[model samples]
Target: MEPESYYFLEHRQDLWTFIRRNPEWYRYLTRDTERINEIDQLAKQYFGKTIPQRLEKAQHNIQLVRMLIDMAGAFRD
Candidate 1:
């Protein structure tokens, strides 16, 4: 699934809340080690960033979640 597919738009708030509550889950959801590392770096960056900055990042991250979910669905096929 492409990141711009709108799946993330529909579930953005829920996914944002989930990530904020369970940041570690990002590692589990993203099967790619590279992505995991990237997220880890991003997580570290989140510490000093403002809420708006984090929300902007969240918009991008939620698309990754949508991609992971779509990939999981593909596995069931």
Candidate 2:
């Protein structure tokens, strides 16, 4: 086994989870353990764990509320 693969099996549960969740990156990540952090970022992005995604979701919710309020106002009028 490659040293990196062994290291992954022995010491990196987070990376293992990342791999399990995103199998497409398995080969690339296993071949280059140096990219583990990059994979971590990808996982955050994929699962909407990043600030930008969260903010976007929040903004969308705000817009939805504003639209609903406007519709309610129109009904009141």
Over 6-75, each residue of candidate 2 has an lDDT whose tens digit, in order, gives: 5754576665677777787778765776776787787788778799999999999999999999999999
lDDT, candidate 2, equals 0.76
Tens digits of lDDT, candidate 1, 14-63: 44554567767555545443353444445555553557777988998999
Report how far off residue 55 is in candidate 1 (Å): 0.7
TM-score of 1: 0.34
Winner by TM-score: 2
Candidate 1 lDDT (Cα, whole model)? 0.58
Report lDDT (Cα) of residue 16, candidate 1. 51
Model 2 / residue 2 / CA error / Å = 9.5
**Position 17, candidate 2: lDDT:** 72
lDDT of each: 0.58, 0.76
The RMSD of every model to the true structure, in order and in angstroms, is: 19.4, 4.1
Model 1: how large is the Cα RMSD against the reference?
A: 19.4
